[model samples]
Target: MASEPGFLPRDGLDRLIEVLRRDGREVIGPRVRDGAIVYAPIATAADLPTGVRDAQSPGAYALNAASSAERQFAWANGPQALKPLVFSPRERLWTSWHAPANGLHFGAAAHTTRPTAVIGVRACDLAALDLQDRHFLREPYADPAYRARRESLFLVAVHCTHPADTCFCVSTGDGPEAAKGFDLALHEIDAGFVVTSGSNAGAEVLASLPLAVPAEAQRDEARAGVAAAAAAQTRRLPARDLRPALLARIEDPHWQVVAERCLSCGNCTAVCPTCFCNAEIEEPVSDGSVSEHFRQWDSCFTAGHSRLHGIVVRADTLARYRQWLIHKLATWHDQYGRSGCVGCGRCIAWCPVGIDLTAEVAVLCDDGEGVAP
Candidate 1:
């Protein structure tokens, strides 16, 4: 019987990267790039998104200089999650030339598992994976690539100590602390971290590290740190029972309020770790003989996302908007036994129209009209 496992603070969690690198795993983490935090492969601990914070609101995001001189990990999530590595933005399916005997081609050519480690995964992203696991891994038709990447990867979730103004994971019921699904969960405590292993795999990794057992007081501080993060959340979406609220008002007029300014740019879906609609295209690689087809990320905001035949299912912006929100808060439960929104607030920050799903939920939860007009 596997039970919860805890580890004491070490010299620095930055050393954990050295441990992973020794095992030949390529570590991808958030790094400061072009005035924003972006996830990329890093060789050292210094590349993390340190000191800088992100100022976010609906339809807006700007980098704020580090609050204190030594703050490296102070920031909200960036414009991207760690999705592109797994569900690439574009991938060719297969290509074939004008030859009958060329044989049919297959998409996503063979690739080796690199044993990658996502070092600085946020609580929201981890929650989104919980939803995605049901859709892509637990479903009848499991996605092989997603399963392979998910199974092979090592997850290190960082609990929020400081949150962005736009952050509302608590509203969607997922974050500020890593509740589950981590090889190692980290709570940044000044120079070191409070590390806990949530699974057997996590404990295996923990056993190899040279660390210290936290005193009872430090354990209490760790718990307080997690609680402080939840308390620091400024924006909140406080709806729990969604079945009665959202499914009841599928055709409400509030959809129009948000759709009016929607540019359909698809930034919301791109940033949303849980929005997993995709499309595939075939293209030639080098030879017309050997062609490849690629599965690329798609979005609900795109006109093609709802295309059935020559007609689109949700034609009007209002209908599309309603479909998105309903799928997020209501029907997703039917499909995956959970709400689609993890409350990461990336959608709120990325929405060019500044449409907030929490605000939308508040409208419906209170007035039964969905988003307010």
Candidate 2:
């Protein structure tokens, strides 16, 4: 295990991937797919999205060529994060069948998870992962499937140097630099990467690579890049702790104004890294001899989410939107000791009509005229 920071030449990225693969881990990294950057299986450094930069704004995302051909992590992030890797989009919980000899029999679904190493992870996403860890791996009640996948993951965090216009991780204290919760952390520079290890497993991997002590100039460049990224952000929440302020405005007229633009399509929740709502469903055979129960990702925006007895709570779009916003920005603090949002801005960028949560929150926090009771 290395005690000092190491520099891995640009070409050495392949060696890193090879090491992870040799350790019997599936290497997943960012790649260009369907007009956007996304996580996919990688075999070598060439599989990464090199020379790609992304442009993001409210309800819009575009990929453009970068000036340098050597930079693979020049983009902020894609729509998907580490959420799908651990908390699957859908998974079977159990299967049940009725037998003549026995009244009924139930068996838990069988599943297998391969150790996976995910590279090019961003700091804000690491923050989101921490929240997900708290939700799924908490004591007294932990999700077995999520725990299995989570335990098998090896995280490689890439500090964000190029931030999108919609990014505001700095305001949320979640990004621009990855502080912890990673096996390895990479600070990408023009010629190479300054690499460091956060865990014992990460140290072992770092020690295996043919690395050099990072030059003072490379260290300086990495620091400058992260600082510039923080400064480049143009969007931010009205305040860090908006719980009291947001809860006070439950009936604010701003909800109605925002609802006009919101489609309640659940796109924000879909892309949001920390939103963890889910629904349990059952599938039965035609003869009803056997049934399979499963859990799938759900959203608060859905009409059925609030259904109780025969009636639906928060029936209108306004109420659903309010519940979502409040839970994300305000109530999450009480539940998780921090805001649910990691300030990745995926919600703003992926929104079809370009509804910006930061802008909406600013308006709601304003003590202006027309604020309703």
Candidate 3:
């Protein structure tokens, strides 16, 4: 029946990397760089950040050497998510040229991308992927480029047994455990990893590796680890769906309070896993022959984002902040059938003012109660 999950010795991770590479996929994993954990190209298992930990709080992030050698992928998500890889924050779309003899010539830019096997994916990001798929693929006008990249991805989600304080995936119904949207889900423990395959691709990789059927006791330990993590979380969005209340309070005074602290730097949208806004621009070559069209990420906080016939709809920071929060928590559900937030807490952690969304929502709704982590 293939119901039993398998086990991989801690050292067998190298073999897993080799299997993916042999399948012609580049491996990307979190590595310690520039004083924080960031996703980068990895070859061998040694490239992964071992004995590393990070402390993340509102408006702050710090990385340090882990005291325990067993905690390699224990840290929370880095600045990057699957969005940049698939949706692409900035990318060349096409090019145009003017020929002296002719009127103009347009050349469709050939975009080349690699198939990737992303390791250390957590549950929240997986839920974000679901949102992105709906936004980029299921829409009437599908993004072919995003679809190509998304289709080529081989996901390996890591069950987060060590969530950060910024994480609120539990409230968002996203994480602490990755039950879906993965080729494989791994639970890392002292001796090794308890692994489960969710797809044929994952099964093929599992079949190639040297693995053992996990004992019932080992499986229980893995379950306990994830449960303990869920218990350790201190922050969460309240279960009372904020969408209805948030939508009704668009003009609430709380917007002005948060706007006062907000720099409007767009850090929240930039770090948000579900924020997929982008702007297209054209750049002319110095020689005046070729013009390149590019797509770059944009934010609603920007003044020009809401421009309407030379007049900005959201002229003030208050309006902009209101638009962002409302879209994220309320209107996004009406548009996408789900909240725009996956509760990764990147927005809270990266915001310059440390403006926690939960705190802001609580203030607006005047509801102090939240789901206990």
What total of clashing residue pairs does each candidate reach? 13, 0, 0
Model 3: runs farther than 4 Å from truth?
1-3, 99-102, 286-289, 370-373
Better of 1 and 2 by TM-score: 2
TM-score of each: 0.88, 0.97, 0.95
lDDT of each: 0.74, 0.91, 0.85
Model with the higher lDDT, candidate 1 or 3: 3
Relative to the unseen true structure, what is the C-alpha lDDT of residue 257 in candidate 2, on a scale of 0 to 100?
Answer: 95
**Top model by TM-score, which number?**
2
lDDT of 2 by residue, 200-243 (tens): 99988987899998889999999999999998887887545889
Q: Candidate 1, residues 60-170: lDDT per residue as tens digits?
A: 888877555455556768888766666667654344445566756444555446888888788888888877778777668887777777777888888876677778777
| Order of candidate numbers by TM-score, starting with the best | 2, 3, 1
Off by over 4 Å in 2: 367-373
How does model 2 fare in lDDT? Answer: 0.91
lDDT tens digits by residue: candidate 3, 1-373? 1236899989999998899886579999888888777888998889988877778888998887766686678787888788888988888888999988987998876767788999999899999989999988876898888988998899888898777788888888898898788998899887789988888888888888899988888899899988988888877776766788987887777788888999989998988888988888999989989999998999999987888899999998999899898888888877888788888989888998898887777678777744242
